[model samples]
Target chain A: MKQNSLFLDRATIVSPHVNGWDEFLASLNCQDVISFEEDWRAQLESLPMRSRRRLSPQILLAISVAEKIHETLPKETAWVFASSVGEGETLNVILDALGTPEKAIQPLRFQNSVHNAASGQWTIAAGVKCPVTSINAHNYTVGAGFLKASMQIKSENCPVGLVLYDAPLPYPLSASHKINIPLGVGFALKPEPSANTIAELKISYCKTPNPMPFASLPQIPENSYNPILAVFPLLKCLAGSPQEDIFLGLNKDYGLCIKVKQL
Target chain B: MLQHPRTNNCGITHSSIVTCLGYGRSSHLLALREGRSGLSNNHGLDLQFDCYLGKVPDVEGIGFPSRVADFDNRATRLALAALVTDGFEQAVLKIRNRWGADRCGIVLGTSTSGVEMLEKTYKAIPENGAMPEDYSTRHHDNLHAITTFLQEYLGFTGPGYTISTACSSSAKALVDACQLVESGLCDAVLTGGVDSLCMTSLYGFESLELMSKVPCRPCDASRDGLSIGEAAAFMIVERDADGYLKLSGYGESSDGTSMSTPPPDGSGASQAIKAALERANLTPNDIDYVNLHGTATIVNDSTEAKAVETAVYRSVPASSVKGAIGHTLGAAGAAEAVFCQYALEDEVIPGNTGLIDLDPALLPNVSESCRNGQLRHVISNSFGFGGSNCALVLSR
Candidate 1:
């Protein structure tokens, strides 16, 4: 399984206004990429749902990116979806029903309660027949899902579509979790590499008494523009300024380091 | 043939294999073996009916971690108790060291992630959507709270993920773990499921008119509905050279028919079971026993029974442990699989405790009391919402 893996290519995220990958990266550094009024107004018209509050901006961003990346859909790629807070809107519906006896559980909301609802929705949207998988690993969700997708590609020798997205929770749930981060979504198209490739990823495990310090790992620069927020750093490193490796330090001081070298 | 590095990839391996050194739920077992119903009438449930429940007794001071705890939730406490038991601590440490905290991963399956906590938060939310400081962080929507707590406690780092596919969650977690190992992703994996009694789940089932007022009797002719209970069970899965119970085969299928309903003819479930048997390269007769996904719900039991009978091992002796544990939801599959391993080791088939007589309509291998015998292989079925089904084969 030492084949050189390629990211192939990805699509440009489309938003209601003009907020794209560059704008998103700029916003991370406290720059207003687009006016709030313009974005909100545009979102109001384009979204399927009526209410402004129901749609989290991050979810919109994620959906936009997903639509783009999946535009030239792979006929035979596996789908892996990762989420931290799953279907925040559905939670609100269930809670609202609990508050009202006459309301009764909405059949649609009930169906959306399963954790895999996002993947299901994506499958329908993408019209892909590949095996779809949804996974939640709390904060480490994206990493875990990525690991699974990577393994699938290696074992099955097929490309994989990895989508990670999380929406801000409904007020009470959102406020309680103390997760104030704006909505975010990331998608990666990973395929096994060919011979004589420049970059490679090797996942290894070592037992050590002290846990690895994850905070010390190099962070993606604040200025890099990428549709996928999570993998922006790796993308930047891959775009020419090659790093030998990027390490995701895990518990027990264990590290899953992705080693890369330019040929 | 292409010779890959064989990087000890995709499976578990270690100097000291983490194992389930002991099981302390025999007291619950003792009560079941004697036919004493763990189900009781409870008014605390928010549902309209005065239903029966298999509530853990005398758990007054069972405090969930305040950060993630909702006073009424029982799932977290149960998982903590299971993980803190005598051998569990050592096993956690051993796995942590063997795979390295960063390289170790935890995968859990659950139908409800602290829904009891969510219920409390729902009751207290202000009309304006304001919430108490800790309301959002409660364990309910933090799907990985348990895994996060476990990761921090045990210092495992590989990959932590949770799978929620209704009843088949834990079994699906096992499937995911095996894939992870087979793909050379992680060295060791901890896979299991947990669920607790909550108004949302209990009442949801009750509203569907699926809760049985009396004890649940799986594969019984007169069986009515399910008796919801709470439990958390985990197993350490590693690439082993001489593992006791090898996860020989697994197969998963999806029936897009409906979420809360079972597939009409059990065709989906049958496919999964047959696939597992075929993957293991063993005929149905090779399986000594079967742990059914017998939720006791009318459709579930009947459909599952038919599927098992149609499976390659049609005549193989089978029983649903739910009769004893009262349907532990997500934990049902993992818990029963562990029980199956024990049954294989002890050579005793625990009786279908609550089933007085086998249902004539449904054909399955049913029995009473523990039968002394050598069980070599077992197939466990777990079917969940949205027609998600998984079958796993564990061999001694």
Candidate 2:
């Protein structure tokens, strides 16, 4: 575990309540509930119109958070994008079209339906040829993505970017898989600590006798379900300082134990 | 495919595959060695045009244990069938006992998971846009359902997840599984992929005009498009211990070029291949065989040919198992890894099953029939949608 520790260079968050790290910390510090903001979408509008037009909300929010962290990341950084049910809206559109008489599936929507669409779009937008992967662990997506990123940093010995995002599934399907809030969190993690490092984290896997429950978490709006919300505790820890190691529920029987040190 | 030092101490202890070629590694090896193809006229789905499909026989016929019965679906069923094959289940249990259940995690890949159930459920909706109360999206509709199902069924309690990068999904699973063991995160990881046939892919490819009207003829001048297939390939990658093949090296890259189309120059694919070679401590000249990600799509085949030419010698024997089993999509990587294993174990290069009228501009040694040869180091390539690419190197 000592060798697995990596530096968290920077982090970004986007949701209805907050759009960046400072805003997130402010909301946590104040304990005030707030409404959704369109700032993330507004920021994306600055990109080329051709790329932004067909982008799904899931991708837009994910890219917004990633773009925030990308500015300070190395150009060769690899990316790992995680989501539970990716492009749910896009899938709804396709499923709806499948039942229609025309059965006319939009070419772009079909292409975007893939889980890796957001990662691919970011690569093209950033003109990066670095390694990339899209991950899904149902509700365990954040744990899975973070594990991949940290392992990549250890194996490749380079900077790795992790983006976790999920939007509400369109109705009907949404009822079956409940994720009402749209959240995206990006982290720029490195193999070595530097002056810009915000936190140092060492991740280890263990058979958790009693996995931490969501009820114990700090009250954040809509944090009960969304897999992207799994990062909240770690984020809160970085924002301030926590004396104990954080145990995140990855599954029913296993957990990702993170020891974080504020730097 | 970067300049990192090679890491060792992990190898594939056991594996199982269920494809149109049939169940277990023996069936696939026999088919590959005999130049037999599993493609037939499309009958699994109702499509408007003529095409061939690598449909597994009686996927719905496989019964599940009562513990996992509720989680049953086409994808999970496919995985269940593989889990019981080739002694893979026994291998997993051995590893679990050796390194506690929590030390054995699962990391799988899939393009479209058990979405077939969702498509079926959607068709039966009562117009209220609400799923049936009994439907378990957590076990059947989600991408990680397969992983969760397998984890519960196998009693693995470690870090389990699924990677869904379109066609390159499972290939990357092998890469991650190797890393999990090397990083000391897990003693062993059950890795591979399972993507069953669904309307999403059948119609999705049709929308993109990437479906073929006949059996896919990979690397053939007359190749029109791909023939979508379904499969589940699972393998136990563990630390140390004697195994049949070593996962020597792997490379992954995003084309960052296009969603559905690979870059014409194949630069992304070349980079992955070169990085794999460098990590394996081998040069292009040391490669014995290459398993290509030939979907038979015009651009994909041409671009992959260019990649092989630039990264590996054009003269090295390379063949795509897709022509034999159709494009297994997410399963292609692990399935082809099994093919690479067969090439190393049996020392035979799989034939290009549907390939005739070979493209004049492609590799010179795309074998039209299986040939016995001495094989040591082999590479398998899997490039997916969003121009995601992964190449893996395996050695005997």
Best of the candidates, lDDT: 2
- List interface RMSDs for the candidates, in order: 5.1, 1.8
Relative to the unseen true structure, what is the C-alpha lDDT of residue B298 in candidate 1, on a scale of 0 to 100?
81
Question: CAPRI verdict on model 2?
Answer: medium
**Native-referenced DockQ of model 2:** 0.69
What lDDT score belongs to each candidate, Candidate 1 first? Answer: 0.61, 0.84
- Highest-scoring model, DockQ: 2
DockQ, every prediction: 0.26, 0.69
Per-residue CA lDDT of model 2 for A60-120, tens digit only, reads: 8778878888977888888899998887878788878777766778888998998888888
Q: Model 2 off-target regions past 4 Å?
A: A1-3, A29-42, A209-213, A220-224, A241-243, B1-3
Compose the digit string of candidate 1's lDDT tens values, residues A233-262.
Answer: 444454455454554433334434555444
